[model samples]
Target chain A: MSVTAIRETGHLPDLSRVPLVDEVGVEERSARFQTRSIKKESKVEALRMVLSMIDLTTLEGQDTPGKVQQLCQKAIHLHDAMPGLPHVAAVCVYPTMVGVAKKALGKNNIKVASVATAFPSGMAPRQIKLEETRIAVDEGADEIDMVISRGAFLQGDYGFVFDEIAAIREACGDAHLKVILETGELGTLDRVRRASVLAMHAGADFIKTSTGKIQPAATLPVTLVMLQAIRDYFYETGRMVGMKPAGGISSAKLAIHYLVMLRETLGAAWMTPAWYRFGASSLANDVLMQLRKQATGIYQSADYFSKD
Target chain B: MAGSTSRVPVEKTYKIYIDGKFPRTESGRFFPLEDSDGEVIANICRGSRKDFRNSVVAARKAFPGWSSASAYLRGQIIYRIAEMLEGRREQFIAELHLQGLSKRRAKKEVDATIDRLIYYAGWSDKYQQVFSAVNPVSSSHFNFSVMEATGVVSVLAPNESSLLGLVSNIVPAIVGGNTCVVLASEEMPLCAVSFAEVLHAADVPGGVVNILTGYREELTGQFASHMDVNAIIYCDSDTDVAKEIEISAADNIKRVVNRTNTDWAQEKSQNPYLIKETQETKTTWHPIGS
Candidate 1:
């Protein structure tokens, strides 16, 4: 249970010593982020930045190989009509679909991120979860997104959750590891902060907000607490951790709000796709519609955009 | 009797209604509404392009649930609108009179507006039956056509009559399951805002009907060109305005209807063709025995 066993996290503190989040302050802070106005050149620049930061996810139970390939194609050649647009940061999928996504996105700069640890409901045994990560890695995934066992964490078993994440990070090898807090299940902003610290200290390269399966996923307050956790982590260890808000962000305006929050909270250092991402499926189309609206001086339609 | 100050007159500021909320124009500008004597009665919101943009967002958000709702439910909602308007007939008449209409004509306009709502209510569930067809095919197939709502529609209400014109243009679009944003007459917007209250009480969902008070010249280009809007109902006369809408609408291949020639006061104002104007004919074929 020593810090040495938790990957290379040598300068980390135990969970009991990490500061607890103030719920009211986080709520008030999250509300204030939406009030700032981003327009004209700044708005166009933010829209383009948001387009590049997207993860372009498809995690349905009925996702077929054809569907994953189609999504990968969309990730590569988004709105060819609007030239000079940026490609999405990555293509996120379930462990079983990682091979299809990786093969279809051949030679492209976009990364393939696979969700493991029995995602959404992380209730599997430790051995099986490690094997799932190994398989996703063997299938050529560039990043591995592992979910923390909320049940164990909620029962005051922080050590178990920390060990499990470390084991998965070891299995990820050269691939980047993203730990999903699934903040919707954590109940309070305090627990969200605690869980975020635990994941980062256990060697998470990125901390994602949700599995996109639960309601109230990736809310602003939840994301703010996690971003603060990332900020505090960098202040101590001097190593930056990326962030991804996965669910309920389907519109261009809301996505821009998230970018604003990211810049204000974490500063300009983490603005790149390498440090921030949106794990979404429909968000790409909305951003494209807004881009087209800016280009043609008219409203755009889903009929004209490529169907995801 | 005790000496007292005379009662202060209560004047209402008519604002644009979008997403079921009464919000002032994002531009924060207003135009005065004058009585027959040219005295300022009140200042109505001069809705800007951003207001129209917000309304389109609301209409697009409301389009799916509305288009998928049962036809029987849509008919019931429109019927409820007629009931609500009937209760507010006097208020509408008084507002029309203040805007320079004669008492008799104001009453007639309110009456006609009520009848128009009921007319569309009846057709809400029956228009598909009358207009849809089972086509004869040359192959071993069963081919049939049905009317589908054309998503979000934008309407430029007629400037001639405040109450009847706004109701006539809006009822048909909602009856056919398409959500709409109507630009109320600049000269007479009181009845239009009051009608929004009637719609609010009638169980009609928000964003299904948004009324804006503004100059058509400023908003016409946006209404016709917005990519989210599926159709534009131009109910004004100026040939230049019509040309602008037609040209802007071509950017997205949006369906633009020129209903400016029709008189809203007559019996001919309420018809199924107005409903058809915002609906698409969707056809499906099935092999008889594959």
Candidate 2:
């Protein structure tokens, strides 16, 4: 577990050098992003972009193969009645259901993302976590969303958390790796920023906000801090990273606000699904409902939409 | 300070009520409700189609819990609303008078409104038993039918008898466990917003009864067309507007209840059948011994 073998150059940035988050500034800036009015055609475009950037996810203990298959179907055909709608970026599930999701999503160009590393709570042994990542990647997961060891991270064992993320990233092989900070457990915006930098340096292709298993899973201020970290990381290393804010964002209006924040913080270069994603279970239908309202000039009903 | 010069009277802008909160209309438009002498009494929210859409969303969100609430609890809450209205009796009479009703007629309408609420409150838990039936079927099954709330309802409160009419339309729907989004009389919307405060104070849950004041010409189509609203009850005698509502309601096959030309002040207006209007008959067939 030598620290020098983690990257190609074997060089990790100074952990203490990560900038401290200005709580007041971040809150004001994030709140300001919501005030920009996107109307008509621009709104419709933003809605479609939000749809394309979604990682249609179902990560419940009661998740069956049938449920996984149904979620994949939803990813493929999001409101078939509305023509010209974009399909989602991916379908996220547990490691055990990755194979089921992969088979169902066949050739639809929608990726199958699986959570590994003892998801939600990363309290397991490092070796077993690596094994889980390998298993999901072997089962045809296009992307791996692994949780960080919050227990160790909270205990000031930055090296241990960094090593675990680097090991998991290696086990993912060609599949992209998304590091989950589960910011709700991190407790502070400063810690969230520090963890974002550590994950990006440790070889995470993406830094996600939460595992969606905690209260206050995702919020504007936390997301703003992570986006700033990514921007700074890109400026220093000349390498781009992705972002995924999962859970608690269920409205079309709120999702549009996230888009506004992304555009303002990261600029147009990071607007596509490859650079950003939303890990949500109930967000797809809401976006569809809004689109239907836009099309017919009448508000929609959940009764008409298929329940996932 | 006690002997300070005379001050200007404070005027109020009556906003719409949605989900137990009073918010100005999203459209930011207002209409002046003038007295008989053509002097402006107050500015009322000119609620738009967007407001109706938002209220429908609130009503639909409230439907599941309200529809499943105990019938006894619903009855008690309706009774509580009557009590709150009685406490505010003078304020409502003054509002009715300000809207151009004669002083005596205003007092009468306010009292009748209170009694009407009590009448509906008494019928709340009993209507299901009165409306349900145990049918004798040809098969060996115990066939029984019961009344169930018809999800979200959209109401166009009568233009005339503003206070009494608004309460009459709202009470029956909610008594049956249905949530409603109601549009108050455009010409006389003062008491409707005031009555919303009574509902708010009485512990009628947010979204159970949302009150909006606006022009019917602009909002009737939206109220009827919303797919989330299960029924639409229009109280005006405008056949053209009613026909328009009926046509828009056909999109979702929504239940349309036409109470056109009904006088709310009469005793005939208070009946158990009004509660049945926004209710659905759900018949259950249980297997029994042959």
Tens digits of per-residue lDDT for model 2 on A105-167? 999999999999998898889889999998999999999999999888888889888878877
Q: What are the clashing pairs of model 2?
A: none
User: Tens-digit lDDT track for model 1 on A1-308?
Assistant: 23324445743357777788888998899899898888778888888999899998988899999999999999999989988899999999999999999999999899999999898799999999999999999999899998999999999998899889888988888888999998889898888988999888889999999999999898898999899999999998898899999999999989998998999999999999999999898999998988887776777778899987
In terms of DockQ, the best-performing candidate is 2
lDDT of 2 by residue, B1-290 (tens): 24577677677768999988999999999988899999989999999988888888888888888989998999899999999999999999999888888899999998999999899989977998899999999999999999999999999999987999989999999999999999999889999999989999999889999999999898888999999999999987878987899999999999999998898889999999999999999999999998
**Clash numbers, per candidate:** 1, 0
Predicted candidate 1 versus true structure: per-residue lDDT over B1-290, tens digit per residue: 33587776677868889988899998999998888788998899999988998898899989999999999999999999999989988998999998999999999989888888888899988999999999999998999999999999999988887889888889999999999999998888888898888889998899999989999888889999888799999877888888888988987789999987888888877789989999999999988974
DockQ of 2: 0.89
